[model samples]
Target: MSTPESCIVAGQLAELGHTSLYDLLEQACREYADKPAFSCGADSVSFTALRSHADCFARYLRHEAGLQPGDRLAIQLPNLLQYVVAIFGALKAGLVIVNTNPQYTAPETRHQFADSGARAVVVLDKLVPLVRSIQPQTQIERLIVTSLDDWRQPQEQGDAADETRFMAALAIGRTLPEIETGRGLDDLAVLQYTGGTTGVSKGAMLTHRNLLSNVLQAVSIIKPGEVEYGNEVRVSPLPLYHIFAFTANCLASVFTGFNSVLITNPRDLDGMIADMQRHSITLFTGINSLFVSLMAHPQFDSIDFSRLKWVNSGGAPLNLSVAQRWFERTGSVVREGFGMTETSPVVVASTGNTPYKEGFIGQAVIDTEMKIVDDQGQELPAGEPGELLIRGPQVMQGYWQRPEATAETFTEDGWLKTGDIGVIDEDGFLKLVDRKKDMILVSGFNVYPNDVEDAVMRHRGIRECVAVGVPDERKGEAIKLFVSLHDQNLTEADIIAHCREQLTGYKVPSYIEIRDDLPKSTVGKLLRRVLRDEARAQVQP
Candidate 1:
C-alpha cells in the first residue's frame, strides 16, 4: 500500500542521532572539519570554518547583545556565503531564523520583521538603507550587514553610523567565550513564510525535528553511493530563502560534507555554466526555466558533464522538454521533487537516474504519507485527481502564532491539507494536476492550467507561458493563455493545433495570446494570479 521509504521514516526517528539543528552542525563539524562546506564567488568555508564562523556570530548574540533562546533572527540575502554564516550561526545560537525573500519590497520586509518580532537582522549591505528607513516600525536591535562582493574580507570595525559588518560580528564573537545555548529537539528552528489562501504571508513554524526529518528523508532519497561524501561538487543556484533549496541544497549538502558552489545570479546563464564547468559539478539543482536558459546558452555545450551524477528540479514543475534536453545533453537524468514551505519542502522526489515522467513529480519520499481526498474529505482512489493531504515527520508543527489558521489547515485526523490537486499512481508516483485555486471549470469539465501550459510548451515555438480561466457566456469559464515565443514566426493557429494534438477541446486555451514575456515570481514561477487577474479585467464591462 505504502512506498518502501515510507516505513523507514515513520518508525526510524530514534535511529537518526542528531537532537537539534546544533547537533547536526556539530556532528558535521567534527567529522569533516577541513572539508569545504560552502562556496560563494571565489571564497569557500570549510566545515570547521563554518563552525567557527557560526560559533563566533553566536557568541556575539549571547555575550555582546544578551539575546536569549527563541529570539528570531531575520536573514535577508540571496545565495551568498553570509547567508550560510548568519543562518547556521543563528541556529547554533538557538534563534529561530526568519528566511526573508531578498526581492521583497520595503513594505514587505517591514511586515515580516514586525510579524516575526525579530531582534536582529543579517542582511545584504546594499539593502541596509531600505531596512534602516523602516527600522522604527519593528523591534530590531542588531543590524549585521555584509557585502556580497566580499563576504570573506575581514574588517575589525564596521560603519559607525549604521551597524557592524557580517565579518565584524564573527571577529567580535571569536574573542568572547563559547555561546552557552543549544535549543532542544522541539524548539523552533525556522519561520518559512508562505502566502496561504488569505493572500497574506503566514509563517510556518518548522521545529528542529521537522528540519532534521526532511534532511534525512532527502538524503535517503539520494543514495550515498551515488554521491561521494566531502568530495561531491554541487552548483546550487536556488536562493536559500526558499524552503526547497534551503533544506535540499544548503542543509543536505552541508550534512553530507559536499562542497556547494552558491550562485548569486542564476539568471546569468553563461556564469552559471562557468561555475559548473569550474567545479566539474557532480550535482546541479535548478528550476525548469533555469535549466531551459542553461540549455539555450551558447556556451552550455562546452561544459564538461563527465562527473555530473545528478540534476535536480524543484521550486516549480519540470517541463518534459527541459528534462529530455538535460538528459540528452549531459547524460544525467533530471529528478523532479514536490513539496511546499510548510512541509519542510521535500516530501517526494524521483529515485536516482529515473527517466522522465510526463507529469509525475515522484514517489513519496521517506516517512512521508500522501493521498488524495475529494470535496467531502473522503479519500480518493489511485489515479483519481483530488486535493492532496500529507502526513509525516517532515511536515511542520503548525503555522507560527496563527492557531485558527493552523487548525483549519490540518484535518482532525492530523493530515496537512496541501491545497494542491494531484493523482497518485498505484506504484506511488505523484502527478500534479494544478493548484486547486487555479482550476478552470469549462461547462462540467475540470481544466487544469498546468495541463494546458505543459501541452503548449511542447510546441517548441513556445518558450514560456501561463494559462488562466476567463469568463465565457456558455461554458461558465474558458481558457486564456499568455505566452512568450522562441520563434517569431509562430502563430496562434500553430499553438491551437499543437494543443489539439495533446489535449481535449475544453482543456485547450480558447484564446492564445503571445507576448514578449510573462510575469513571474522572484523564483521564476509563473505568477498565475497575475495572469488570472489580467484575464478577468479583459472581460469586465
Candidate 2:
C-alpha cells in the first residue's frame, strides 16, 4: 500500500487557495472552465456554467433577498443542481448554510429552523407545504421554492407560473437590505446537527477552517494523479445533508473539480442502478445499508463494477457477510472508515490497496490524534475497548449555543470525547465495539430513544414510555417502544398512532410492547440497557 508521502502533491490545487468553499469552486471554474461539474440524468452543468449560475444565485441572495454573511440559510431539497447552486451561493455570499432533510415532517423541520435561527429557506416544491406550515413559528423571513423539474426542463416546457413566483421571491430580495461581509475562516460555515446520547439534537459548529482542514486531510490520503481535476467521476447517492457525504462527496468533488453524479432519489433502486450502468463512476461512497440494498437488487449483478476504483463504507458498521459478497461479486473491497458529525465527519479511512478487515474502522487520517480512554478519562492500553477521544483540526469548535454540553464533550486537555466504544490494535487499526450513547442507528441515521419517549409521553393516555433498539434485518436497528398507559383500555395501536403524529418515520417505534411498569434504578433513572437486553433476548431463537 502507498504511504501518506506517496499521495502528497508538490503544490496545492488552484482551488486550495480559496478561504471559503465558494472561492474554491470559483477557482476551479477559472482553472477547468469547460469540465462538467454536476450531472443529473441527462442534464449536466459545466464548471464555468456552474460558477456563473452560482454567481447569479449569490448575487440574487445579496441584491434581491437582503441576506448577509454569517446569516443562516436553511436548505431543504434533494440532491440536485439547485442543491449545489444554493449551497455554493450561500457560502460565496458569506451565509451560514444549515442543511435540512428534505423528508422532514412539519415538526422536525420547525425544530431545525427555530433552533438554527435561519432567516431564509430554499425548499423543493413537494416540501413547500411542510415549510409553509411551520413558517409562522420560525424565524424565516425569506422563502424560495423550486421544483424537481426546475432546471432540467426546456424554458417553454417549464412551469412559468411557479418560476415567476420563485423569481418574485428572488425579486423580493432587492427590497431587503444586505449586511456587511466579514465572514472569516474561523466563522461558522455549517450548522450540522447530531443526535447526542441525551436525545437532544445539537448543531455542531463547523467553521471554514474545520471543513477545509478535513478536505486537505482527505486529499492527503489519495495518491497524486490517481484522480485529477475535472476528470474524476463521483457517485453520491447518500443524502447531502449527511456530513459524511457533504464533505467527502460534495465538497471533495468541488475541491478536485470532479463530475459529481447527483442521485436525487436513491430509493428508486432500478433507476439508480440504470444510472450507475450508464456512468463509469470512479469513486463510490456509501453506508453498509446502502451497499446491502444495492447487492440485493436484481439489476445489481449486471452493473459494471470493474470501472469503480474506490469504494468507501462509513456512517455505520459494515457487515462481514455484505463485504464478502461485494468483494466476490466486484473484486473490490469496501474500505471502512469512522467519523462523527462533530468531527467534520472524516477521521479514519482504509486506503485503496489495504487489506479488508472484517470490523476494523481503519487508522487515523494524517495529522489526526486518536486515543482510547476509560470511563474516568484515563488513556487505556491498546486492545482495550473504551471511549475514543480525538484531537484534530477538523473537530468542530463546539455545539452551537450549548456551552455546558460542549464543555462536557471535550476533555480538559482538549480531546473530544467521541462517546463511541472502540479499541485500537497495536498496529493502529480502530475497531468499534459498541456505542456508549443510547442512540440507535436506523439505516445509518440516528434515532434517539429519548426523543421518541418524550413524544410518546406527550400522549394524554400514556403514563410512561421507554424506547429501545431492536435488531432488524433491513435497518441496522429499529426502535421498539414499551408503554404504560394511563387508561387500561388504551391499545398499542392508539399509542402508536399518537407517536406517529409527533415523530418522524424513523423515530416512530416499529414494535409496541405494553408493560405495567419499567425497570428503574434506586434514583428512578430508567434502565434502558435492561430493556435493550430483554428486546434482543426476545428476538433470539
Residues 173-232, candidate 1: write the lDDT tens digits.
Answer: 989997656787678999998765433568999988788878888888766478777888
lDDT of each: 0.80, 0.79
For model 2, how big is the CA root-mean-square deviation?
A: 4.4
State the displacement of the C-alpha of residue 367, model 1, in Å, after optimal TM-score superposition: 1.3
Model 2 C-alpha lDDT versus the unseen true structure: 0.79
Candidate 2 TM-score, true structure as reference: 0.91
- TM values, all candidates: 0.80, 0.91
Lowest summed-lDDT stretch of 10 residues in model 2? 1-10
**Which sections of candidate 2 miss by over 4 Å?**
1-15, 154-182, 224-228, 353-356, 488-493
Top candidate when judged by lDDT against the true structure: 1
CA lDDT for candidate 1:
0.80
Best by TM-score: 2
Report the error of model 2 at residue 294, Å.
1.7
